[model samples]
Target: MKRTTLSERALVLAPHGRDAPIAASMLAESGIDAQVCTGLPHLIEELDAGAAFVVVTEEAIASADLHPLSDWLEDQEEWSDLPFVLLTSRGGGLERNPAARRHLEVLGNVTFLERPFHPTTLISLARSALRGRCRQYEARARLIALRDSENRFRTLFDTMDEGFCVIEFLDGPHGPASDYVHVQANAAYERHAGIPNVVGQRLRDMVPDEADAWVEMYRRVLMTGEPIRFEQELVATRRHLELAAFRVEPAERREVAVIFQDVTARKRAESELRELNETLERRVQDAVAEREAALAQLHEAQKLETLGQLTGGVAHDINNLLTPITGALDLLSRRHADSDPRSARLFEGALQSAERAKILVSRLLGFARRQALETRAIDVSSTLEGMRDLIASSTGSGIELRLVPSPGLPAAQADPNQLELAVLNLCVNARDAMDGGGVLTIAAEQAVVGPGDAGALRPGAYVRISVVDTGAGMDEATLAKAVEPFFSTKGIGKGTGLGLSMVHGLAAQLGGAFMLSSALGDGTRADLYLPVAQAAADPAPVGGNDAIRPVKPLTLLLVDDEDLVRAGTAEMLRDLGHVVHEASGGAQALAKLGPDHKFDAVVTDYMMPQMNGVELAGRIAARDPGLPLLVVTGYAGGNLDVGLPQLAKPFRQADIAAAIERLVHGEKVVRLRPRRDANSAA
Candidate 1:
């Protein structure tokens, strides 16, 4: 919609040539562009291009047929009104002439000047006509802008997805303006509301029952000019409508514009969802109650489990105490009935039962006191290598055993016998963890320890002995208590739970620390830290039972807190052809030793009511520096820290004889000195 401007060209339709030139000159001087035309045909050409005004003579208008000009003027649009300035003679009968009057009527906006008119009068009339033409062009531009705005609005209104309608309030004879007519509607209004041909119709005529409420809503909007939004059901179509109504053209008539949508399905779904939520809440409460009952039952089951563990530990301790009794009885039975050798097999079976029972008892006391340790310097690498066969047999065929000792592993200051037992215990635990077959690795490496490195062990050098198992590992809770006495994760009777505990006790007693680490599925690793020995490891004979040289029988002192064990040991010493002096404890033994008595050796129990064996031996050695001393202990309990020969309880007669003979004959008498440092042996 583009507007056309007033043309600069003013067509002069005068018939005389001189008059046309003069008129052109006058227009040019007046700053108006003019074109002189000879005839009506030429005038038509100029008018076709565009024109501001037309000047014509009375004769030209009277003689000529102005139908072409008439047709051009009649074809003009509403915004166009081309002005014409007619030049007439004085007393000209142009207005009376029928043809001129006809032409004047066709040319709608025209000005006339009589003959002998002043030049200024003609110029002023011509300029006034041009000014009116310019105003017409301005009107045309406004019309075009209005048309474009209407077209854009119409496109937007028709393309909207929501229903839209413009309603004009219609007043009745009395009362309020209660009726509203749909003056305009978009395409979506009929589709969404399910009502067609609703425009140009009164609300009361279309839906008599629903009309009043809707008319009231429209009246409120028109009166107050306030926008409102509400959801309501239309009874005529059974549709739920979400509508927003706002007053439009506030300065003009009362008209309301409505934008609405169909939401019946959404409303139905909301009702169903509310019912479902209520049902779920009840079910959740029921589930919570059931869970509480289950938790109570679980707590009762845990109580029974704890009782079973206590029973197992008690049974194990009883078995340990009975082991020595069973062995002694078996030996006595063999000695009495050796003539009838058939009775020996029955005694042997009894011994086997006792051995089995002992193993069960020992498992329950896994972290209990271990036997006395004879601490010495030993190569950790060689120690592990030597125990390969024993470890393999104990772990069974299901486990693959590997003894991987790192090159240049230093000798560790610990008892070789105790270290071997600790490694075996770890391997056995690893075997049980792997229900299926897996690899058990025993490795040794040299480690340097600075201050605050290994717990409770003085900073220096160390030998790290690691036992790793490719088996089911432990969780954090289980690993935290792995080294606690009798805290087994295995089922009752499956394990004594003393494996890690005993290893931990052994390392600590040997002036080192024990560390265990595991993850749920990543298997377990146990590390035994033993301080590095200052001297090279002694490679001693494996066994020297047959190599003992018989020594002459000598007087010996025997000491024990237990009356029965002391009597039995004294009787054994007398049977071996040695004179024996018996004392109840370290106090009595020290009293018996005086300047008048001569004794070849002193044998005493490590744990007594007062002045135990290690203390007694130290005192005896102080009194008689050359006197040989030996310690016998049932359970050392980490108190055997004296550099003296030790004999573990439940030893055979041959074992006692060998120890006494070695000390009496000057074979291997332990050096007694003002001790450099107390022994770290247990």
Candidate 2:
């Protein structure tokens, strides 16, 4: 009782006799489902309802209206071509009967089966028709599946975020892959590329200027069937894009799929960030350089201050020791002037050597910027002339000396003795530089300084005395520290390293400046600038005091902490025909004073224990304001403001006598001393 489907049943139309019944029986016996149509009207109705095939006799529709049956065949779906098995009388086949052709025209897909033939022939023709109808149904199912897949693909392709397109490479006039056509493109394509309606449009027509690059990129993907990813700029639209391209399957199809997105903003931000980093890098370098310069300056100041303190302390002790030696030697030489010739000569030689030691100590104090300077107006030309022979002897024969003093040059303010020593030191250094042989030129010229010039020099007229030498010179690193105390490049025991430092200190003390310039393998030049003198140079003094003796021998109180120094000074004072009271300290010297023992003057050492010379002077002044006081010191600089007559130590008997005589006579002893601040020059 199951219902039959169109593809599983057959319709029989043979209403003329037992033809319809006989055909239905044959189909039923063959195990095929069949429907018996009563007439042509029933056949049309059964055809509309659907059947796999039809079995009809020729007599039934040969002379009847075949329009409805023909119309049904014409109205069938494209995939439907209903099969028919036609039963014909003798000579009723299409080839034998002319009427059979009309029936064939009505049944589009029909097979002719002649009547009076075996029933096997009818059954075989019905089976063949049903097989053809089954194939048509399978084709219809495939078409429906293909249509549904296309719907889903189109929906996804249109909704994706990234721009997508299918391009078909074309062979153009130029060559293969010379052009490509955009066969398929999605909605995002226009938004990303700024081109609209690109389907079926050639790349050359859309962006002619950039077409070649685009085609070449995609052509490789198509030819090699490989995928590529890259970033590129679309010159036509001025947009930067990140794109990925892959060849479509089946290489011969010559198609590539491209996915891309706009990346212009990101690229611009990266460019800006790169520039900002470069700027910051330069700023950081500049800041570091500035900080290094400041640190170097601070280090130099601290180093100089520390060195000055150390040098001053050492010079003080040495000067104290030298004072006793020099005083004893002077007394011995004078006493032995009429003794054995050999003994007298030995004493004189020792005295001369001690004087040299005193000069060396003075030079050390100068490098420390604590030495007292005797600055005065002096003719540089005359001074150099006087030292010509002496400088020549110091430089030796290998070096040629040249002195070029500018004519009409004004006098410069400086210590003449120190200036001569500075020039001699420079010449000796020049001689050392030239191991083979070279010329050493000393020149003097007038210079005027203005504000904002180098070397921090005060604006004034000055005399520039330069020492130039042709010799192996110093490089920048060495030149920068040439004037620093004890920073020497010479081998040990060859140089003291204080020559240039002494020169620099001397210049500064005299209100001048010193500068040096040199280059490796070129040569060196040292320039000393001294301020112009306010007055003309003083004329040479005639012979006066070769030996200073006090006006008359008087009672003297001599106080010093060093036993040897106090004993030697007491001996000198007694030999000068003065009654002397020797004390080891300020307190001892104060105790010696009483009404029975009167003293004409008190000579005290500035640096001592128990009480210093200044404090002792104050106490003595309270008791006897009219008594003369002389303060002698080994330490020459730094905040020693004693309002009494002062004499630097390491002096001969004549120097001490001169100081005491000046004090006793109330004569002012002018001394050029350094300021209270140790950092400032004298």
Candidate 3:
């Protein structure tokens, strides 16, 4: 319900001239909505301004050139039948013309009366016309209001510079693809296409590929009976178009309406984004590959560094043993009489030195290869259980051996033999530390070390086998070199000190952490943190198989570029009771064994001029088909042992005896195991 306010009311008046005053008098009396006009033209202008009705004298129509007024009256719209009245003379015997009656009828909504009519009659007719005119005035007011609103909307939409378009379905085919025609478009669309009229044309004709896409989209929408909206790029014109289209079906119309905007700049930005993504992906791949390669190289360097350390330590320990081993055996043989029963003491001393040499050689072989290993991953509890007898023996009968294994202990990857040796070394050291006798306690538990536990150690669980002793520990100076080869706290000649160094080397090789703690008065604690190895793989043994093969002996022609070695070896051969010849050089040896001498064996030293051991052996083997020749040298030439036995130089007389005895018996020389230290950890 709309309420009409005072300002919206229409006013009425008689045509300008004689009745204008009377109409004013009627308005003054009535106090209703009203205004006055001079003529039909003035009436139209007043109506245009805001007049609603008009009144006039009938004689003015007779005297007036009424075509202008008639043309104006004819122009009045059907709904706005402007209320009009005519005052005429009815008493002068004037007759109305039929044509004029028809003409007056053409001028719609007209009233007439005689000139002498009462004021009440004029007022009654005026009031009725006023009422009808007010109804027309309401209709006219709404039509004008609509026109104003349309103008406002058009002004706003047209002024915006961004391109916008609206599409609607038409009743018939519209293009080559028969795309639905557009019903409306804003000024931007017209500007883009450089066309004045855009509406009623198919979308494809206006935009590229718009026909094929839009018709298919509309077909889907018609079936789905749902509104679909999206942003898409059409590729036909090689231009980026950011478009949003939606299906719209009206209640009374079958056409689906689509509204969209053009966003080419947005599409270009998205393309650039994809290219940037490709570049980032490539960079990430390169970074990952570079990181992997760096890690690989770092690991290789670490392995080589560890190998160098172990080799140097082993060499140093062996060098220290060489003097005692070779010198002792030589002295004992020269000094001890065969008839003297007590002379066996000197022989026994020499035997111990020789055994030490053998042990040193075994460690070197182990460093080279590990093939047949007695490996079993056992927890500290199991390890302690097996060590009771050995520990008691190492610590002495007076001192106690305490095995304290933590609950839920993890298993350590170790060879029972190797691990036992290490433990024994520690025990022996402890027993030596506690000369007055003290307790040796072994603590075992699962250990987890992250960066928080050790400096830059990768986080993982391990078996921390800590051997703690209640004996008097070493001073700071002595403790620092506890694991250095041949470094001993004991007085001179009491300890060889290869024990702890071996433990350290073994732990490092197993990828484990070895941490030692000790104070002047406090007992030592050596914690061996072995990484969690696979449960069954223990420390494997190396050189388990004798790589040397057996062969027949040949007529002997032997050489040694060194005097001591050559004379000693010849003496050893005489001891073995074999017929032999000796030469100071390779050339002399080859001259002794002629091409047709039918030699049974040939022995030659490798590092010699005038035909080295390799050339001598090759010439001999070429002459004899089933002969065994042994090449002895500190260093071998390439291909020196291709078809014959090869031996290292600086050997004992017994080693030479063993090599020949084995070769004569067609038995290969097997590498012996290192005699492990039994009194390790106490």
Best by lDDT: 2
What ranges in model 3 sit over 4 Å off?
A: 1-285, 288-292, 295-299, 302-343, 370-556, 577-580, 595-600, 605-615, 631-655, 665-682
Question: lDDT per residue, candidate 2, 338-389, as tens digits?
Answer: 6667877787778777766777777666656576776789999999988999
Q: Compose the digit string of candidate 3's lDDT tens values, residues 108-156.
A: 5566645665454456566666665655555545555545655654674
lDDT order, best first, reads 2, 1, 3
Ranking by TM-score: 2, 1, 3
> How high is the CA lDDT of each candidate model?
0.71, 0.77, 0.57
Residue pairs of candidate 1 with colliding backbone atoms: 89-115, 90-115, 316-361, 373-682
After superposing candidate 2 on the true structure, give the runs of residues whose Cα lies further than 4 Å from its correct spot: 1-283, 286-302, 338-349, 404-410, 445-462, 474-498, 513-520, 532-536, 539-545, 637-639, 668-682
Any idea what lDDT model 1 has? 0.71
The residue-by-residue lDDT of candidate 1 on 1-682, one tens digit each, is 2323458668887887477888888888889999998898998777777888888876786766778878877778866767777776543245354454555577756655666554555676677667666756665665566556556556767886668898998787535687888999989887778899898998888889888788887788888887777787888888888777777744267888787767776666544544443443344344445545544544433333333333432442243244355546544553654666666666666655655455444333333443346689998777887788888899999998888889977778987666777888998899988888999988888777888664666777788888999999999988898987668888854686657777888888888899888997789999888998889999854421122235578899998766667777776677567899999977789899998789988988776654667667667777888888888765432234566777755554556788787666646666545554334222
Tell me how far candidate 1 lies from the true structure as C-alpha RMSD in angstroms: 52.2
Q: Compute each candidate's TM-score over C-alphas.
A: 0.37, 0.53, 0.34
Best of the two (1, 2) by TM-score: 2
